[model samples]
Target chain A: MRELAKMVIVLTVLSSLSGGLLAMLREKTQDRIEQQVLEFVKGPAIRKILAGAANDPIADRFTLADGEAKRSFFVGKYDGKPDVVAFETFAGGYGGDVGLIVAVAVDTDQIVGVGVTTHNETPGVGAAVETDVGFIRQFTGLDIASGPKVTKDGGSINAISGATITSRAVCAAVGKAGDLYKRLKPEILKQLKTFSG
Target chain B: MAKTVTQEFVKGLWAEIPPFRLVLGLCPTLAVTKTVEDGIGMGVATGFVLVCSNLLISMLRNVIPSKVRIACYIIVVATFVTVVELLMQAFTYPLYLSLGIFIPLIVVNCIVLGRAEAFASKNKILPSIADGLGIGIGYTLSLAALGAVREVFGSGTFLGNPVFGPSFQPFTFMVQAPGAFVCLGLMLCLMNLAGKK
Candidate 1:
């Protein structure tokens, strides 16, 4: 009984010490970690997409909404019009989750740009979605009417070589994002008008 | 005392290699070893945490009760992992982003807890520190070797730079999940061959 009591006391003390240390460390770094994650996800990609607009609204000020299974993005204003309203779409690829941040020009319903956010595909093959500028660059200025299909399938955009699965996945994700954009456009436009007024 | 410490430190390199021999921490070993750089980053981060946790755990071993020792060790290991995570995020954001969830998952890595129970709990502080260093080096070398094999063939690059000449047609599949297994198996075969000598 004495040995068990001693053991319990020792364990309790050690647990408290370790927990206290971790809590202190977490308090110190939580803010910085949140800031870094935000910057990493929204840095250069968002800026590049919004560059063509006449007015540049703060990307940081944008609000994010999670719908049933989609992510809705609302950009405040660009010049006299809503800059771009977007929905990020995700799909499973050969490696893992492939996410695309897609924005459509509010005026023309054209794709502003598509950014490959998360991917774990094979390097030089599916991973080319990030390194191959041509694949991503084609998304810019493309309207929903163009049909988001690979060139081999009789569409305008070419699929990445040796990474057809990942390419197809991205293409499919962008197509879904476009569909969501069209569905959300009316409500987004109303919200934009209210904000502008 | 010095001899025992040396033995504990050196044992990890051969007798108890974390991934290849012991088959512990296979998740990060396979997941982050797409490139030599990422492997090295993970290895070093894990090494730092291991060393710190081992030292602390060994020092507190006498004070921790046997029944709850495992729980106490986990708390210590997790605290060190959080510190390493925060430090990497602040100083090495790119590497941290590349490592992603695997960094936090280190808290549950069998190798860390394995050493905490097997060696640190019964050993003196100096010897436990030595054991940590040895195991950490072994883990790092294995990851780097794996990463090197994958990056060279899979991408025709080493550490994100083109190492192979332009004429080299890279085998894209070598960097994928299947490739991880292939490379690891080949490495084990080679290690076995070396052991025979």
Candidate 2:
């Protein structure tokens, strides 16, 4: 009976101490961890798509209900007006769902730029889109509402010679982004006002 | 009680080095040794947990009941591992991504529990600390050595830099899982041969 009681008391004390220590650490690191994730995982692509923005798009961000799921959107200011927004969209690729960030001009309804943020496509073939500057460049200044597509699909954008599926996936992702933008434009504009100052 | 602090510490470095002499905690040793950076990061993380947990366990040795000591050790070790994980996510996000699930797995690492049960519970505070440091650093060094061997041969690069020349063809096999098994086996063989002398 003495041993059992001792065991219970010791275990309880140790567990509580451990919990307290971990809780303190978690609180201390929560904000910084969120910041680091933003800076590393999504920063490069946001910076590239919102190139030459007057403000840091990665820093100037907002999330809104796009249905049941809340999706984040990055804001880009050009000449001091936040008129372009970037958000991620996905479509099936050769290996998995390809994540593409499509930046659209709110005022002109044209694509500011597009960048491939994540993908699992074949290297040197489908995955080439990551650094295939010319391929992604084709989407710049294109009308977002037209639903971007490849030349083979009766669209002007030329697909990479060997990665038709990945090219189609990118185009489909951009189209999805177009639809998302149209759905969230009102909430996004309202959110952008908070950053306008 | 008879062993000095220095003796306890030094013994961990070579005589009972976690991976080679004791032949334990092979999970992270094989998985993260693909790069010197990863190896060092994992080593340092594990070392921090080992030292901290050992110190705590040693301090609480008398208070903890023998029946619940393992439970107490786990709580202590888990708290430190979580602290390391959160801190890593906050400051070293890239390394955190590379190490991934292995950081949490440190809870089950026999080295920590083994030391707590076998050495720390029976030792003084100073000796426990020394033992933890020695073993932690030993683990780090072993990981770094294995990582060097694999990275140089597999990727033809050291810590992301080209080691030989651009012309040197990478032995792709050394970077995969099977290569990890072979590399670890060879290292164990070498350690055994050296010990025989």
Candidate 3:
């Protein structure tokens, strides 16, 4: 009984100490982490797409809304014109989830750009999403008219060689994003116009 | 005490390698080893977490109750993981973003948990720390080797720089998921062969 009591006391003290240390660490870094996440999500990719725009990037101005399943995003304005709105989709990839960021030009109803925010696709092959600038750049001006197919299917964009599954996954995600944009464009534009006025 | 500490540290490298020999922490081992840099980053992060957690757990081994040991270990491990994650975010944002969910997932990595339960729970603090370092280094070395194989064949690059020059035709398939398995399997086979010799 004495041994057991001693054990219990030691365990309790250790747990408490460790917990307190963790709490202190979390408090110290929580704000910095939040800032880092914000910068990462909105940094280079958003800037790349919104290059030369009179207004700030949509990621900077917009608020993200969580729906039942999907995420909806609204960007404020560009040069007094509501130019972009985005929607994020989570797609299953070869290794894990892929987060696709699709930004649309509200006025044109065309894709402004598409960025892969997160992916666990194979490193050199499926992960070409990040490494292959040309492949991603193809999405810049594409829209419903492009029909989102690989070069093998006579489309303009070339798929990453030897990573058909991952390439197809990205293609499908972009296609879906385009479809969603088409469906949501009218309402999004209406909201933008009201807000701008 | 000195002999025991030496044993604890040395054992992790060969007798009980975290991934190759012991087959612990396979998830992160396979998931983040696409690039040499990522592999090294993950290895270091995991090592830091492992060593700290092992020391703390060892110090508290006498006190934690048997019935709730697992829960207490998890909480302790998670706290360290969170600290590591935040540090990476602040100091190595690009690498942190590249690692993504795998960082948080480290909290559940079997190697850390396994040590906490099997060894640290019954060991002295110094020996546990040595064990953690040895195991962590073994795991890191394995990841670096895997990353080197994938990066060289798949992209003709070593650590993000083109090694074979532009003229070399890279084997794109080597960086895919299948390649991870193939590389690991072949490595295991080689290790077994060396042992036989």
Candidate 4:
């Protein structure tokens, strides 16, 4: 009984100590990690998606609260006005959660571009979705309020050859982003004023 | 029978080196030595975890119940690995991306648990630090040496720069998995030959 108590106490104490240290370290590194993500992961994707924008989209960003979570929005100015906004959304994919960044023309509520930010999909098959230019371009100019779907699901978009699941994941992420955008459109527009060049 | 702190430190560089002499922690040793940059990055990250965990484990050795020592050591090692991952993601995003899944896998690397169990658990704090530092540096040196050989022969470049003239042809086999095995074997043989005297 004494040995059992000692074991339990030691394990409990060690786990909690480990947990506490991690939690504190996470809190301290959260902002810097977020910044690094912007500079590395999101930066290239956003720059490519929001191409030709007069202002740097990555440097012009803001966050708005939706419910329990805060979502960041990157602003792109074209012809000296903050006309476009971009954000990330996720959905289940072939390997795990697939992250897709969807950019929208705020005035018309039309998708300007779509890009994959992170994924664990199969290398040559599902991963081809990133470089599959024609498929990605189809998302552009689509109505942001209307949920987009692949052709098999009775939508205009065609799925990538041999990667229907990953294609569907991207569609699903855009659909979820549509719902999020509709809910937060008012707050997003209000925040965009400050970023306008 | 008493060994000084200097001896403990020196042994890690050659005698009891984690990967070569101890023949431990071969996974990262095999996977990340494709480039000198990547090899050094993996080594530094592993060394940091090994040292931090060793220090904390030695400090807590007296208080931890022997029955739950392994569990306690894991908690400590895992916590430090996570801390390293978070910091890398924040400050060295490129290295973090290049190293990928291996950063989190450091928790399972036996060198850490081996040191905690064999050395830190019974030794004083200073010697434990020495052992961790020595083994860590030795591991780093071994990996860098292998990385240099592979990079120079495989790609005809050293650290991404052309080491040979432009006319030189790269031995592509040196960068592949089979090459890693052959290189490691030959290096191991050489080490054995040196130690035989």
In terms of TM-score, the best-performing candidate is 2
Q: How would you class the docking of model 3?
A: acceptable
Model 2 chain B worst lDDT run, 10 consecutive residues: B65-74
Give interface RMSD (Å), model 1: 2.2
DockQ of each: 0.37, 0.83, 0.28, 0.78
Q: Write the per-residue lDDT of candidate 3 for residues A24-133, one digit (tens) a residue.
A: 87788787776676467645555666665655554434332334444446463567776777666656778887777777877676787777877889877898786687
From the highest lDDT down, the ranking of the candidates is 4, 2, 1, 3
lDDT measured at residue A196 in model 1 versus the true structure, 0 to 100: 60
- Sort all candidates by TM-score, best to worst: 2, 4, 1, 3
Chain A TM per prediction: 0.74, 0.85, 0.71, 0.86
Best by DockQ: 2
Per-model TM-score versus the true fold: 0.67, 0.88, 0.64, 0.86
Per-model C-alpha lDDT, please? 0.80, 0.90, 0.78, 0.92
Q: A155 in model 4: Cα distance from truth in Å? A: 4.9
In candidate 4, stretches whose alpha carbon ends up further than 4 angstroms from where it belongs are A1-16, A67-69, A145-165, B152-157, B162-178
Question: In model 2, which regions exceed 4 Å deviation?
Answer: A65-70, A90-97, A119-129, A132-135, A146-172, A193-197
Residue pairs clashing, model 3: A10-B63, A11-B63, A11-B64
Write the candidate numbers in order of decreasing DockQ.
2, 4, 1, 3
Best of the two (2, 4) by TM-score: 2
Show the colliding residue pairs in model 4: none
In terms of docking quality, model 2 is high
Candidate 3 global lDDT: 0.78
Q: Which clashing pairs does model 1 show?
A: none
